[model samples]
Each structure stands twice: as C-alpha cells, then as structure tokens.
Target: MSGPGTAAGAAGRAGQSDALEHLARVGLIAYGMVHVLVAWLALQLAWGGGSSESADQSGALATLAESPVGKPLLWVLAVGLVALALWQAAEVVRWRSGWSASGDTRKKAVEKTVKAVAKAVVYAALAVLAFRAATGGGQSGSGQQQQTTAGVLGWPGGRWLVAAAGLVVIGVGAHHVLKGLKKGFLEEIDLASAPPTAERTVTRLGQVGYPAKGVAFAVVGALLVYAALTFDPARASGLDGAMRTILDAPFGRVLLTLVALGIAAFGAFCFVRARYPERT
Candidate 1:
C-alpha cells in the first residue's frame, strides 16, 4: 500500500512539472509577441505617425485587448506568465540550495539567485497585468507608476526610497547593455543546434536590441530620480515616458528611429528565443 501511494505521488508531481513546462513555453511566445508589438508601436512613433498608444508594455497589452479574440488571448498570456514566474521561483530555490553548500565560490551563486528572483518578480508582475487586462481592469503604465510613486512619497524617507529604486533600475539597464554587447544572452538559447548563419543573425538582433532597451531603462530611471528630487510624482515617467523623452532630445526623431529599429530587432530575437529556449 505504501509503495503504491509513493508511486502515485511521484507520477502526480511529474505531471504537474510537465504541465508547468508547457505553460512556460507558451508564455514565452506570448512574451515575444508583446515585445514585437511594442517595437512596432515605437517605430510608428519614430515616424511621427501612430496611434495614441502609450508605447510601453501596457500599450502592448492594450493592443492585444483590441484584437477580436483579445480576452481569450490575454487569459492564455496570464496563465503562461504565471507558469514562467513559477519556473523562475523554482530556479531561485534550486540556486539557493547550491549557495548554501560549503563552497568558497558563493559569489556566482549569489548573483544567479538574485537574477532568478528578479526574473520571478517580473514574470509575476506581467502575469498580474495580463489578468487585469483580461478582466477589463485597464490602467496605463505611466499612471500606475505615478500612483505607486505618490504612495511611496507619502511615507517617511520616501524620496530616498524612490532614489534607491531609480538607481537599481539604472543598474539593471546597464547590465542589459553589457549583456547585449557581450552576447551573453546566447547562453539562454539552444543556439548549439542552430545553423551558423541563423545563430549569427540571432546574436546580431540581441546585440542591437538589448542596448536599445538599456538606454530606455536608463532614461526611465533618470526621470524617476528627477521626480524624487523634485518631490513630484507626476515626473516619474515609465517606459512610455522614457521613449517620449528621447523624442524631445536634439535630432530626436532620427535617434528615436534608430532606437525603435533596435527594439524591433530585440523583438525578433525574442521570437527566435521562444522557439529555442535553453533547457535547464
């Protein structure tokens, strides 16, 4: 009786794992689609012709919501995102266990754990947003950020907290730039089985795309810092705001167009990545 029960439990767990993996795979494709949509909107903005979309993640979600089968798609996306979050959480747990081992080289372990935690947070957030969209809970990305900033500012030392958050975001952006330049993202895909030309194309796309995204993130962080210093929550722009800022710079249109193209490249890379994700 004990043996039978144990076997049944094992089978149940295996089934669950398989389901999650499938969900994650589907979620990756959805994620890629969002990025691609964002890239398209950004390009339109660069050309000085586009919808009144926010040109951010929220905008991407909104675009999907506008489709004929948008609600169902959003629901699917929400589930996939949840699966991705779970997968990342599992990674964090697994890494934490290794980090606890008696080893002098804990630095790498710590870094990986941090990365996993960050990814999990992001996946979870996206999942929430998708569910909200599916349920008709519409909210602009910039509006949401401002609301959070306002709430934070109400707290003691809120400015400092905002500043700290800005710095962290800036650091993340810098890391993206570095990762793209180094083609470090290649390690996250099954490029080993890809043809040489195909691999090179994907590498090029990532290299361009990552840096563009990093630039946008850095701009967003800078705006956040400015908002904190000025004690104005209204100034704390999100991704949409950051892109708009780029358009306000000298020769803004040209610069923005280049960035938009880079973003599009990244979107393309994401699509390829979804098809060949690294199996860990």
Candidate 2:
C-alpha cells in the first residue's frame, strides 16, 4: 500500500526539482547564478547572513573571507566555479525547439553533446566544493553555489540580489510549512521514542528539518527585509543574528551557537542531498 505522505512528498519533490532543473535548462550560466543567489539567501537567513551594527555587514563577511582560513576557502570556491557562459549558451542553442525535431542521428549527436557538457559542468562545480571541504570550510550553503556567488556576482549588485533573494527564500519556506501542515506532513516528524516502524521512519524523515528551519529561514528573510526598508538595520537579522539576539543572556550565546552549528549541519545535509536528490 502507498504511504499517506508519499503522494504529497512526490509532488513536492517534483515541484522543487523541476523548477530548479528548468532554470538550468534555460541557460546553465543563469542557473549557476540563480543557485548562487538562493545560497546567499540561505546563508543570510540560516547562517547569520547579515549584521545589525552595520548597514551592510556583508563587508564583515568579506572580511571574514579574507582571514587565512577564509582566504583558502575562497580559493577552493573559485577553483570550482565554471564560467558556464559560452558553454551554457551553446546548450541553449542546441536544445532550442528544433533540437529534438532533428533526424535520429542528429538527435543522438545533440543528446551526446548535452550529456558530455553537463558532466563537465557538474565536475567543475564539484571540484570547487571539494576544495572547501578539503580546507575544512563549514557548510552553510552548497559550496558549489558559494563558488558562483563569490566569483560571479561581485559587490553592491550581488549583495542587493542576495538580500532580495533572502525574502523570496523565506516566503518559499513558509509556503512549504503551510503545504506540509495541510497535507499532514508536519505530523510525520513527531517522535514516539519507542520501537522503529515504517511509519515512524517516513514521518521522521519528512519532519526533521524541513518544517522548522525551512520556516525559520523565511522569518529571518522577512525581518531583514523589513529592517532594510525601515532604515533600521539594527532590526535586521539573519539566522545567526536572530538566534544570537534571542539568546542574549549568558547561556543564550551558547544556545545560539548551537543553533548556528545546526544550520551548518542542515546545509551540509542539503549538499549531500544534492548528490542524491532522487534518493529520497
């Protein structure tokens, strides 16, 4: 028999993946850039993306990136970034409406070209991320995505896009929470603290991180945007900033640190999931 959440989960997966894949399909270069945008938003919302003390504390992030540790990580990130501009442009041309309608031999040639090029792109992206992993860089977002943002969209424009994307991310996460709740996926994560069962596995897997921080990112994004709009940057918070603020008391700092660590873990999980997005 089919599980209760299966249909909902499948539909959700399709919705998310198709949208992302379509972005890549449109123009791989643009796809690379979009992932970079979302990843920065994730960093801000989930990893303490911005600061209250400074209007655009992303400079602090840049400063952090310059540290011996940060410098090496950037090196790793940069190496992985592929300028997919020319490559992706060719792909768009090859796959344009007529690509599929070509004769069988031509179609086979097109398919071969797509696969070969796509594999190279994937390899290039992975190489950059692997450097991050080698340098002991922490996972806040997929390092592959990090590579793109760090190198491609530099400075004021990049920051602006990232900040806007933060708001979009928050909205997306909130939407996920609402959909999960309506479909009863939220209940799937409930713990029994007893013997394992098929239901428990499915429920726990669905519930663990998706509902909570998915929504948390959204909240952080909204607040940060509001703060930016109100001209009160002090009100702005990312995952790190918000949690730290909430736990301002003595032991609170410790709690927030743990939360930050947890976000890093969640990001790592996503990176891993990207390697096997279809597995779950």
Candidate 3:
C-alpha cells in the first residue's frame, strides 16, 4: 500500500518531469510576450497621444485577442501558464517532503516554500485570465480591481486589511529593487554554460528591469493605501492606473519612456530565462 511518503516521492518525481519543464519554459516565453505588450501599451500612453487600452497584463492579453491568431495564442498561453502553475505546485510538494532532508536552515526552507506557493498562485491566476480572454469573457483588470477594492472596503475592518495588503506589495517592490541593485537574481539562474555575450545581456537586462518593475509595483501599492485611506475604490485601479499616475507627474513623458524601456528589457530577459531557467 502506498503511504504519504510514497505519494510525496511520486509527486516530487512528477514535478521534475521533463515534459512539465518544457511546458513551464514555454510559459515563461508567453509571460515575456505579455510584458513586451505591456511595455508597448505603456509607450503609447507615454507619447502616442494616449491609449484606450489599459497598460497592464490583461491589456496585453486583450491585444492578443484582437489579432487574427489570438484565440490560438490565448489557448497556448492558458495551457502553458497552467503547466507553469502545476510546476510550482510540484515545487511546493518537493519542499514539504524534503524540508528536513535538505539540511538547509529552517528559515531558508520556509522562504523557498513561500516563494513556490506564491509563484503557483500567480501563475494560476494568470492562466485563468488567459482562459477568460480566449473565451470572450475577459473583463477590464482595472475595473475588476476597483470593484474588488470597493467590496473589501464595505467589510468591517476592511480598510485595515487593504492597508496591510498595500504594505505587503510595497515590501515586494522593495525586494525587487534590492534584488536588481544587488544582483541577487544571479543566484536564481545558472549561466555558467552560457556564452559571455549572452550572460552579459541577461545580467544587464535584469539590472534595469527589476528596479523598474519594483517602481511600478510600489506605485500600485501606494495607490492602494491611498484608496484605503480616502475610502475611494477608484484609486485602486491596478497597473494601468499606476502608469497614468506616473504620466501625470512632472517630466512624466521622459520617466514613462525610461520605465517602458526597462519593462521591455525585463520581457527580453524572460525570453533568456525560458531558454536557460535554473528553476521552473
């Protein structure tokens, strides 16, 4: 009879499967494409006389939807993102099963577990969004965010909850900034076998990309906090709102242009990661 231990071992093996790894890589490519699209939308907002579409992931997917090959691409994205989520789920299982055997400090193990869980949730959510887009059921991400914020604010003590969530997002943004500045992302990828030029390109992309993304996230989080404080859900308009906020600042056009370029760099980095990921 197979026991819990046996089941865990099976899960671990399944997580390391070659097929899943390939799918996860494909998912990374799709992820990169989304970021590229977002960068394009951001540029439009910055200088192309403004865009009707939101400058966020949902907007990017929606752009894909308008293309002739949109449905097929969306289906591919949905499948790849689901696979990526499953791969992260498998990582969580592996971490749980080998928690004691890995000989790592308890803190490190916990951190790994948390990261895996977070990735799984993020990928799963993206997969759902892609699926919805493919099915013609996609909704505006900013609008959805506003509605959700409004609903949350209606609950007792929801203001505090929202504020706490904002703080968490800010922390995440700070981490990204630190990771970029400190080259901490190098620890996550293996480039020993990569050509010198390729390695340099990847490193440069990451250095520029992470901090830009961090800034964007920080703005979003700040907006969330502001919305909570003012009891205005409209302020919680997600990424697109964040971009617009930046555009409204002094010297906004230059800043937004730089940020858009950084985002494109990040998207390009994702393509390299798809080719040489140390972990799914």
Worst 10-residue stretch by lDDT in candidate 2? 52-61
Q: Give candidate 1's error at residue 158 in angstroms.
A: 0.5
Tens digits of lDDT, candidate 3, 1-280? 7765776687788877999989988898888888899999999999975667799989989989999999999999889999989988877776665566544665576677798898899899889989998998968889999999999999999998888888888898898899899988776566876778878888999999999989998999999999999999999999999898999999998898888898898889888888888762
**TM values, all candidates:** 0.90, 0.36, 0.95
Worst 10 residues of 3 by lDDT: 98-107
Q: Indicate which candidate wins on lDDT.
A: 3
Ranking by lDDT: 3, 1, 2
The better-scoring model by TM-score among 2 and 3 is 3
Task: Quote the lDDT for 229 in model 1.
Answer: 96
Evaluate residue 121 in candidate 1 and report its C-alpha lDDT on the 0 to 100 scale: 95
Q: Global CA lDDT of candidate 2, please?
A: 0.43
Q: What is the C-alpha lDDT of each candidate?
A: 0.82, 0.43, 0.87
lDDT of 3: 0.87
RMSD of each: 3.9, 14.1, 1.8
